[model samples]
Target: MSLFNKALASIGIGSAQVDTKLEKDKVTPGGEIRGVVHIKGGNTEQKVDEIYLGLNTTYLKESNDRKINVPVVIDRFRLNEPFTIGPGETKEIPFSFVLPLDVPISIGRTKIWVSTALDIKNAVDPSDKDYLHVIPNRLMDAVLNGVEDLGFRLREADCEQAPYRLRKRLPFIQEFEFVPVMGSFRGRLDELELVFFQVSENETEIYMQVDRRARGLGGFLSEALEMDESNIRFTVTSSDIPGLRQKLETIINKYS
Candidate 1:
């Protein structure tokens, strides 16, 4: 009976299982996440080689003129070393890690999650998944608020394949699209696309694409020539929040 149970366990019929419980489901970028991994042994003894946790998200990729969803791993953490788990044994491992400052916030179709895996020698690995909500950090929040203060409301937000110049550790970037309702940019601009880059604890860089509304014959011609849009890059610090609107307005005016 014991031999049969061990054989069944090796084939994952009654093997160990893993579950990850996060302290909280919502977190901000650059914040620390605390969690615990629970492992429950089953049927027979198991030799666990290691345990790992990974941060994963999906991004859009273009292939053959079509966009397809592709999985990307943002980061990974090892939670344990080799260990033995007797039948019916249970263990809990505590864990903590810092999220990347540039991680995409969980908005629109963008999703982020933590995955835990238990590696068992000569047996199937057991795994668990827990989704997380990533919000903007203080600096990013301020910048977003500044944009809102300028009368731009978030129209759409999504992660898509990045251009060569914007590629970093990941092949895709998150874009926030906004449209002006009532502000200095209302009449002249059609929409604005914003992308954050090189985000850190102290500072971050921004890329803006200003799309101008066609006004007259000249404007229509410019639009037809694909010249009605302008791209700008700027850097901002936490202190800049006080005058963020003014700085952003000035930059927009330069292109207008």
Candidate 2:
């Protein structure tokens, strides 16, 4: 390699480029993602130390008494040993990964994506970004449907900072807020909030919070702003799919 070519590669004028192609961008939690990483050589041979992929998203974090969005990597995967690509060379690498159950659902302002990059010494690294549309899995769909069947309307969904106790691998949790539209709890309750955590492929834990209607209008409004409270969870399995509604109703009724 000539000194001139090395200098050009260092400035990215003749450095390798990477592009990622996903077989499918829309996926559900606990689903599989398949894709291909294409690397094209520039004017000179470049050494790629490593290639990596990160499953990334953002969550609200309290900083200086204000909420700030911060990036979080839910999972990551790294490829094999160092390799060199000769001038005008082309290479294709196939990759795949299973989505983590704890990955925040792509709802509201939550955005999920896969970041791909190649680490090259003394040169600008090439990268690619592909967004993912994460949908609810079978177990999650069952719970969501169960709530709607009970005359509750989903008001909002968000990924926010998690309490120490409820947190596991991730520092945040996805919350679903609901209001009684035409149910027995309409006047008796103010709102209902839920959180889900999947411990395995066949089982999941649901956290619940029920807010009661206060005495006066002012009280109700004030209580709406304060949704924080001690939470309770129910451990349910794939076998419970048939009776999920009844079980959820039983749990919510106890609080109502």
**Number of clashing residue pairs in every model?**
0, 0
Off by over 4 Å in 2: 216-230
Per-residue alpha-carbon lDDT of candidate 2 for residues 139-182, written as tens digits (9 for 90 to 100): 88888998998889999998899999888889999999999998
Model 1: per-residue Cα lDDT over 123-222, one tens digit each: 8899999999998877888888988898899999999989999988888899999999998888989999999985686698999999999989999999
User: TM-score of each candidate?
Assistant: 0.95, 0.92
- Model 1 Cα shift for residue 33 (angstroms): 0.9
Question: What is model 2's C-alpha RMSD?
Answer: 2.6
Give all candidate RMSDs, comma-separated. 1.4, 2.6
Error of 2 at 115 (Å): 0.5
**Considering summed lDDT, which 10 consecutive residues are worst modelled in model 1?**
196-205
